[model samples]
Target: MTSTSARVGGIRKEVDAQKLGPALLIASSLVLAIRTARWPATSDEGLANVEWQKEVEHSGHIAKAMLSHLISRYPSLFLLKDVPWYVPTDEDVPE
Candidate 1:
């Protein structure tokens, strides 16, 4: 009986641990969604769009231009080298 109780307790702990990950992921996504929805569009966002258009017009890819912009704006987060360019849509501009 004692071993059965211990086994049940261990299973409960494992289930709780597995639940923790998805719960945290859902919570984080909710927070991010709320924050992004609440964020006001800035002039920089528009500027970035114009810059992107110009770059794409001048060349084929806006990767270099975006890299420069990211370097200037968010240097810490910027990965200038070997960065994966995954634009969501052709009309989707950087902010």
Candidate 2:
């Protein structure tokens, strides 16, 4: 009975150590990331101004121009949501 209780206490200590270790690591990392973070400027950061410029160039029809600019600036893998350029539909003129 004494040996069994000692083993159980040891196991509980190990489990608690494991759980608290990871929790502390994650908390410290989050604090470090928040304190020393330098996020790069994305295209959408100044979206309104960019769209306004595109609108002027495209005569208030900025959809295609904005998409082209975005694709050129960012990686093709990025998924932009609610942008007019990405809707899938058949082109009116058949190839």
**Top model number, lDDT:** 1
63 Cα displacement, candidate 2 (Å): 46
What value of lDDT does candidate 2 attain over all alpha carbons?
0.40
Question: How many backbone clashes does every candidate have?
Answer: 0, 0
Candidate 1: tens digits of C-alpha lDDT, residues 1-95: 11222111121111222333444455445544554575566667444566435533444223335444655676555222332334244234355
Span of ten consecutive residues with least summed lDDT in model 2? 5-14
Compute each candidate's TM-score over C-alphas.
Answer: 0.26, 0.24
**Which consecutive 10 residues in model 1 have the weakest lDDT in total?**
5-14
lDDT of 1: 0.42
Please state the error at residue 72 of candidate 2 in Å: 53
lDDT of each: 0.42, 0.40
